[model samples]
Target chain A: MSKQELTILGRAADDACCQGLASAPLDEQRAADLAKIFKALGDPVRLRLMSMIASREGGEVCVCELTPAFDLSQPTISHHLKLLRQAGLIDCERRGTWVYYWVLPGVLDRLAGFLAVPHSAKEPV
Target chain B: MSKQELTILGRAADDACCQGLASAPLDEQRAADLAKIFKALGDPVRLRLMSMIASREGGEVCVCELTPAFDLSQPTISHHLKLLRQAGLIDCERRGTWVYYWVLPGVLDRLAGFLAVPHSAKEPV
Candidate 1:
């Protein structure tokens, strides 16, 4: 389910790269789809998890390492990680006893591109 | 209250412009603050409203104009607008009977900048 969602999101990001938010109004289906991605990043815990995973030097982090950084229970942290994965922002794999996570390559930059205002739109009218 | 929140959010965005999400792990306070902004944009209605207002040729849109585009009541639209305003992504003013809204100058770009991954961070490890 998560991989399928990521493919859908990847397509949306590709479409967004061409027009961006300021270039034209978003259609309802696209808006609904994109909203899910933004909603996933809407929580403080989730955002921090994303930062932790995205900022890791070796491109991925083990679940054991991540759970120690927060005051929340390991279950709670796992739930947040699940949401990020569902949003197509990150993916995880089990290695021995631990699950390792990494931000999907270029997802952040694609989202940034979608939100960015084109230079032409920024000029005074 | 809204103005004060905007100021705080503005300060956060300014700090974010210097170091994006992927640059380092976010501190708790900053993550909480940014989460509010992203939460505001997480709604499909609000995202559509933002796109409409931001894409307007004249850089502003009246409340009357925004209402007709949605299947929702005027008050509902106003409420969504209020959330966006509180998030510091947009601002509004009353002119007689109508409220006009415009995306706060450079706010979208700043947010885009904050989410953007630094080129160096993308290098294969």
Candidate 2:
């Protein structure tokens, strides 16, 4: 599944979705996929979680480290992490007694590219 | 209301949010604001409408031109537009019989900037 998503992101980032909404009409399927990613980011907790994970040194962080930062229960934090993982914005691996999570850069790049202002559109005259 | 948003955006574009999630932890209020915008973008129908309006030749589009693009009723489209407007992603003006809507580039620029990959992290070398 991770490999498939990598392929999707590679394609999306390299070519399929490099334009902003102002550049062209977004197709239905792409809109659906993008919507899911945005919806996954539609919560404060998850958004903060994503930031913490993405900003961590070594580009990944342990679940044990992550849980302490939130006021919520560990299980609640796990649920938010699960939702983020399901959205393809994050991935995790079990390592000994703890699992580590990291942001999928390709996914973020695709989303950012989609919202990018074209060089022509950068300064509206 | 719009003048206020533009003031906020002008500041946001100039300084307040020039980094991606990986650069720092998003604050509570900013997180809430961004989440609202992302949630407004969570629906497929609304996403399409945003694309259509943003991609229009004049950077603005009429409701009459927008409604026929969807199978949904005018009221349904209007509801989605209302949500998008409330989120500050787009704004509309009533002119005689039709309302014209246009993308708020400052808002998009802010969102895109927030998701942008830091230059140093691009290659991950």
Candidate 3:
């Protein structure tokens, strides 16, 4: 998204926060956009890929370092990385031929805010 | 899972925190279990269904009230509810003909914790 469009979307989201969910059902376009992001996270490989990127020291890790960590082929790892980048959850930079990945802070936070329960929840049995 | 099994699983998860995602690849059973839970969250209908439940004022909401909030049919809402319940993300209780659902705290916290980055992250560009 362009910086202008993202700002508009964020402002709209903030404005619409607690009108309750269906007060503004995620319109079709928003639903599709959100679904693409979640679909990227639905796989186990992507989940772990996200964690590795998010939790790595310096808040990022190199593609070479990531590949050997999984038993899967390098190509498979590359494919998952591609999905993460597309989802807007992580960003990559090319350092020569090797790429590095880093978590986009507040991306996960945005998701958590979407799922957040009211602060008043009681302990579950 | 039996209470015993659940406790054991919980303990193992606690014990294994931050050895990093691959310091132990989620063993097959754990991966399958977690994947099922995430798959339940992968859909927009289900995600909104969960949000409605978690954000309800009483820490729970009745199924009857939940159904009307969506454009979907009662049965369709019920199907999404079943998926959430199966994922153990929410619990249901029947009061006469109405069933109420409540969020399972620490469930989302567990997921948030899984996606959690280090306590320190600089602002993203």
Candidate 4:
């Protein structure tokens, strides 16, 4: 079975389809794929979740630790984690009874690359 | 009216609510506000739109120029623009018949700040 991989912005770095959109129009498939990744980052719950997990001590955190951090229920937090995971922003491993999540650095790095301002480019008024 | 001023990641830098979420759980209001911003970036069309306008020549581009970049109709593009504007990612000005849009550099800068990885932090396995 194909693991429902979450892009986690790590995938986004690899998904260079975004680079073309500015220079030209996006085809349907590309738009859909691109949209899926952005959509993953669309929720505040998920955004905070990603922030928490990404910046957690040891550079990785467990599901048990993440669950109580929010007012949300376990399933809800799990749902958000699922989205982040699918987006490829994070990766998880089963260690004993607990599952740990860690930031996929490469994806975040790509997102930063996309947002980097060209220093030589004239500033917009 | 307290402007529904979209956050545009520009606000994210100032909001500082995100900073706490990593170490602590987010309060209700902050989560909602933060979520709204992420929701705006959630759409594929909007993401592409921001990329187009942000990276355009002269650091600004008009709605007319943005319209043809996607397969969607003008109204759809307009809707996406509204979301971007509300999110504070892009600013729009009425110039005669054509409305020009420019990247809100501050917001994007904040987003980059939030995503910046602490170099001293160990990489996640």
DockQ winner:
1
Q: What is the DockQ of the complex in model 4? A: 0.42
TM-score of 4: 0.78
Clashes found in each candidate (C-alpha, N, C closer than 3 A) = 0, 0, 0, 15
Q: Which ranges in model 1 have alpha carbons more than 4 Å from their true place?
A: A1-4, A120-125, B1-4, B120-125
Summarize candidate 4's per-residue lDDT along B9-79 as a digit string, tens digits: 44554564235334444555565665666577677787777777766767778888888877889999988
Total backbone clashes of candidate 1, pairs 3 or more residues apart or in separate chains:
0
Candidate 1 differs from the real structure by a C-alpha RMSD in angstroms, to one decimal, of: 2.3
**Clash-forming residue pairs, model 1:** none
Tell me the TM-score that candidate 4 gets on chain A alone: 0.77
Two-way TM-score contest, 3 vs 4, winner? 4
Lowest lDDT 10-residue stretch of candidate 2 chain B: B7-16
TM-score of 3: 0.69
Q: Write the per-residue lDDT of candidate 1 for residues A1-125, one digit (tens) a residue.
A: 23646788777777776778888988898888788888988899999999998889988999999999999999999999988887789998888887899999888888998898766656656
Model 2: colliding residue pairs: none
The runs of at least 3 residues in candidate 2 whose Cα sits more than 4 Å from the true structure, single-residue gaps closed, are A1-16, A120-125, B1-16, B120-125
Q: Which is the better candidate, 2 or 4, if ranked by TM-score?
A: 2
Q: Positional deviation of B95 in candidate 2, in angstroms?
A: 0.4
Angstrom error of the Cα, residue A43, model 4: value is 1.2
